[model samples]
Target: MTFGWLITRYMYPCFLPMGEWYRTPMDKNGAILKIDLADFQPTQHLDIDPTHHVIVNGLYMPHTVIRHNERLAYCDSMAYRVEIEKNAPIQLQGFTRGLAMTDDTIFIGQSRMRHVLRIPHAFSNCCLDGGIHVYNSTYRISRFVSLPAQQVYQILVLDQDFSLERGGN
Candidate 1:
């Protein structure tokens, strides 16, 4: 995870939260620093879980953050891929805006291409087609699912089916 240009921000600003962007120091222990909202200055250290290693450097601007199981998902639009930090890198493409996890898959919305996707068995640092891809722990794409293009902003996995909602629709 080389997040040299990645940063985190709050999706909703109703409360005017600050220090959303964070920086991971290149120290031995991987310390995190909260970038000042206004000046982009290093304000404080925001400790992440010690169990998972941070691989990427910077985050995408206007990124969305989602957590499933023990991993944190970063929808990096600038990078054009989704990164999961837990055990490995789950590479997604086409500028993801939002994501959701179901009982057996992880779904994401692509803003640039107007599509929604799913990874059957998600893993870290891997790529799949513009469809559903399942991976094993070894980071290999194992399964795949197909979706339609409609400028999806988010994906919701219902009890028995999946639903995609467009961003501007």
Candidate 2:
């Protein structure tokens, strides 16, 4: 299985007490690890970007990665972009989290930053709300549905013929 790495010093800030926090510096690189299930060991490790600084706690974090049609696609949460294999990164309007794709559509979940020290310069003046942004095959925003919650962690695609009766079995 493939796993995306956050590559940070502080792994769980949410588990800390209300007023307490960690001030350690985070690693400035992102990586994807491929593990062998039979032996439970890592077989490969690919850095997202090593030459250029690509990992920032709240700016360029890799949140999710998925394989679609034999190609890899992932979200850069705070950077508000989705990087697909052999294609330019698709820009989004908010912090990207969940991601699902079909033959002609891409669904992305947006969320608000929690406990961020400072807003990134690229989005300092922008108001990013939680929502589901749907994109077309050509990488255009086809639709957007604003959600009432502060965060959306995951998204799953269901087939057109899927039904409750089939799921219960």
Candidate 3:
């Protein structure tokens, strides 16, 4: 009824599949356990073994989840950067949560400030103020729109026109 090492490091090992448990050894606490679905099961692992692991960069206190194509991205609060598995570098800059992805653009909710940040797919850097900010493929801020703020919890891109409308049901 126990997986030995899996039970000591991970909780409820008998109830989960082998692949669902992620070995995030790169984390400061050790490893970061993950599941394919949020509701399928909770609780993961943190491998502190420094020899046979590679902790993810800038993922000390990850909080948000955003889908980037086939990859899942999120922000590490303690590390202060957006950490993604498939693209670019480890940490982007500024802590992030509430991830929203579109065809050519991506949006993230800033934890420190009350704003929804925009980072274009084409460009390397972007910004946000009150409403919205549009960025080109070159990572430059091209347009800005005034939007009402209420401590943004999350965002989602409906179409490719660079529009972020909040919807929670």
Candidate 4:
């Protein structure tokens, strides 16, 4: 769906039970996280969109996922295909294929095209690092670094995942 459709579906309300943009991520039935837009986190860093293009701002970094940037129109790369199961730990080989996959393993495809996603306001082009999101309660990811003769503490990132309510009338 186009960004316009996203606005109409999430930000706008209909006679049905659809909610506001802030209240949506929809569900497996509708658009999930992959296509769902997350508000950009205001930071002094440059962000990269899913199309491998630069989504910029004042402070910028290279190759890092922008706080609120998105990727769309993706395809599965057979060579780099990865599937991770729920409640199971991921080794972080790369970004999630698409936020849509819920059951079994989250499928992360490859971004091999442009035009699918675009940037609104850009600052500069830098691609060095990237990041991911961890949602509330039942949803999240835990990471730790190991050092010689040192104890490791797990770090947790809190995020909220929202979506339109499902109903039958």
Candidate that scores best on TM-score: 2
- Candidate 4 per-residue lDDT, tens place, 73-138, comes to 221111111222222333233222232233222322223222213211221321112232222214
Clashing residue pair totals per candidate (backbone < 3 A): 24, 0, 13, 22
lDDT (C-alpha, whole model) for all candidates: 0.42, 0.60, 0.41, 0.24
TM-score of 4: 0.18
lDDT of 1: 0.42
Winning model by lDDT: 2
Using lDDT as the measure, what is the rank order of every candidate, best first? 2, 1, 3, 4
- TM-score per prediction, in order, is 0.41, 0.65, 0.43, 0.18
Q: What lDDT is reached at residue 145 by model 1?
A: 51
Identify the runs in model 1 with alpha carbons over 4 angstroms from their true place: 1-57, 113-139, 142-148, 160-169
Cα error of candidate 3 at position 163, Å: 15
